[model samples]
Target chain A: MFDIAAVAVTIAIMITMYRAIKGPTIYDRVLAGNAIGTKTVILLVLIGFVHDRPHFLDLAVVYPLINFIATIAFLKYREMGRLD
Target chain B: MIDVMLLLIIVVCAIFALFMKDLLSATIILGIYSFIMATIFTRLNAVDVAFTEASVGAGITSVLMIAALSRTKRYEYHYTKLQRRKPSALFLKVISLLLVIITGAVLVYGTIDMPEFGDPEAPANKHVSPRYIAESEHETSEKNIVTAVLAGYRGYDTLGETTVIFTAGICVILLLRRRINT
Candidate 1:
C-alpha cells in the first residue's frame, strides 16, 4: 500500500523533472524544481520508515527550513536581478 | 493490498505530473505527491520522518516554487521542429539517457544487497542505531529519537547543514539585492 503511494510520488517527481528540463521559461523550471524538493522531503521520510528509523523526522524538519530559505533567496534574486 | 493501492496511485500521479501541460498544475500535483509520501511514512511506523516530510515537503517547498513562479511566466513555449533543430541535440539526449540508465542500474544493484524491509537483525539495528534509540531519551531528554540523532550524535553535521542553508540564503540575497548607495 505504502509502496504504491511512493511509486506514484516518484512518478510525479519524474514528471516535474521533465518540466524542469523542458520548461520554456526559468520560472517554470523553478516551479518544477521546487516541486521536486517538496517531494524529496516526503521521500526521505518514507525511506526512513521503510528502514524502520523513527528518528529520521529531524531531517524532515530541517529539510523544509533549508528548502524554504533557498527558495525565498532565489525568488528574491530573480525579482531584483541581484542578490543584495 | 493497501501497499499495492498506494503504489498504483503513485504511478498515476507521477504520470499526470509528467504529462501535464500547465506548469502550475504540475507543480501542485507534485505537492500532493509529497503529502501522500508522508502518509506512507507514517504507515511505515516512521513518525519522525513523516513529521519532517509534512512540514518541509508540503509547506516550505511549495511556497518557494510559487514565489518563483509569481515572478516569471507560468507556461512554457513548445518549440516545433520547424523552429530549428540541431543534430547534436540528438547525441546529447542519447548520452543523457545512457547516464540515467547507468545511475539507475547502480542504485538498483545497491538495493539488492539491502536487508529485507523491516528486518530487525539488520546491521543498522544492531549497531549504533540501537544504542541511540535506547539511550537518546535519557541523554537528550527529547522524546523524539530523530531529534536526538540530529542534534546530539550528529551535532556537527547538523551545524554544517545549518551553515549551508545560511550561506545559501546569503548568497541568494547578495545575488538578488539591488545596489544601495551606502
Candidate 2:
C-alpha cells in the first residue's frame, strides 16, 4: 500500500537528513539536499495516491523541475564562486 | 503519524541549521527543511501553498542564499572569548532564551480555547468557507474553489502579492545595475 511506501520514504528522508546535517564538505551537503529533493518528489506523488487526490501530482512535477536548478546553481557557484 | 515524522525531521533540520559552522551547509539544510515543509503542506491538502513553498523554499531561496554566501565567510567562529563566555554574550543568550520560552508559553496558552482539529463547528469552519465552497463554481465559473477564491473573490490580495514581487525585482535591478564602461 501507499502508506507502507510513504513510511519507507520517510525513513529514507531521515537517513538523508543525517547526511545533510553531518556533512564533511559543502558538496556532501549539496548532494544530500539534492537526494532529499528527489525523495520529496517521489513522496509527493505517493502522498497524492494515498490521499486519493491526484492534483498534488502537479506539485511533484514542479518540485523536481526547480530543485535541480537549485542543486546545479549550488554546484556552479561552489565551482566558480559566481552565479554568472 | 507521518506528520509526526516530518515535523520531527523539521526540528532536527532547524537545530542543525542553527548550529552549522558552514554557512553553505546551513543554507542547504534550510532548503531541506523547506522542501519537507512543502511536503507537509501537500499532505495537508494545500496544493497551491505547497507549490509556492517548494519553488520558493527549495529553489529561489537556496540559490539566493548561496549567492549571498559568496560575499561572506563560511564559518562562524566561536573564538576564545566566545568559548570563555563573555558576560555580555551570556546575558544576551539568557535574555533570548527567556524571551523565546515566554513567547512559546504564551502561544500555547492562547491555543487552549481553540477548537480541536477537524471540528466541524470550529469558528474557521463556520466561517465563509461554506459559501466559498458552495457558490464559487456558480459565481466565478471556476471548478476549483481555491482558484476561484484566489483569482475572483480575493483578486486584490493576489495583486498585492504581484506588486510586492515586482517591487523586489525592481529594487534588485536598481541596486545592482552597472555601466559597462565603468
Candidate 3:
C-alpha cells in the first residue's frame, strides 16, 4: 500500500519537475518548486512508514517551514527587488 | 524504486539548472534538487544526514541564493541578452564542459571501490558504529542512537558546525550593518 503511494508521489514529483524546468515565468518555477517541496515532505512520511521508522516525521516537519519561508522570500525579492 | 527516481530527478534538475537562462529560476531548481537529495539521504537510512541536508540545502542555501540574486542581475547576461555563441563564450563553455566531465569521471572512479550502500560490514561501520550503539545509551543517556552519535560521540563535530554557522551569521551582520559614520 505504501509502496504504491510512494510510487505515485514520485510520479507527481516528476510531473512537477517539468514545470520547474520549463517555466514560462519566474513565478511558475517558484510555484513548481514549492509543490515539489511539499511532495517531498509527503514522500518523507510515506518513506518513514514504509521503512517502519517513525522518526522520519521530524524531517517532514522541517520542509513546509523552510519551503514556505523561502518561497515568500523569493516573491518578496521579485516584487520589491530587495529582501529588506 | 522511488530512490532511483529521486536520484534521476536530481540529475535532471542539475542539468536544467546549469542551462537555465534565468538566474532566479535556476536558484529555485537548485532548491528542489537539494530537497530531493535530502529525501535520498533519508532513503539511504541516513536520517541525520537528511536532516542536515534539508536545513542547509533547501533552507539556508535557498534563502542565501535568493538574497544574493536580489542584489544582482536576474538573468545570465551572456546567454540571455547577448550572443551566446561568441567565440570566447564558446571556448569557455567547452573548457567548462571538459572540466565537468573530468571531475565527474574522477568522482565516479573514486566511488567504484566504496562499500555497497548500507553494507553492515563496511569498514567504518564495523570500526565505529558497534561501540557507539552498545555504549552510547549508558555513557550519554541518549536513547536515540543518532542523538548519541551526534551530540555525545561526536560532540566536537557538532560544536564545529555550530561555530561555522555562528561565524557565518556574524559575517553576514558585519557585511550588512549600517555604518554609523556613513
Query: Model 1, B50-75: lDDT tens per residue?
Result: 65565556555555565566667666
Residue-by-residue lDDT tens digits, candidate 2, A5-63 = 99999999999988888878788888899999999999999999998988767668878
Clashing pairs in 3: none
For every candidate, how close is chain A to the native chain A in TM-score? Answer: 0.87, 0.90, 0.92
Candidate 2: tens digits of C-alpha lDDT, residues B26-74 = 8899999999999999888777788778777877777777667777766
Please report, as a residue range, the 10-residue window in candidate 1 chain B with the lowest summed lDDT. B168-177
Best by lDDT: 3
Chain B TM-scores of the candidates: 0.71, 0.81, 0.79
Interface RMSDs of the predictions, in order, are 8.9, 4.0, 3.6
Who is ahead in TM-score, 2 or 3? 2
Top candidate, metric DockQ = 3
Tens digits of lDDT, candidate 3, B1-182: 88788889988999999898888888899899988998899888888788778767877777788778877888886644356757888899899999989999999999999999778889989988889888989999989988888788789999999897677556444433344554
* Interface DockQ of candidate 3: 0.57
Off by over 4 Å in 3: B79-88, B165-182
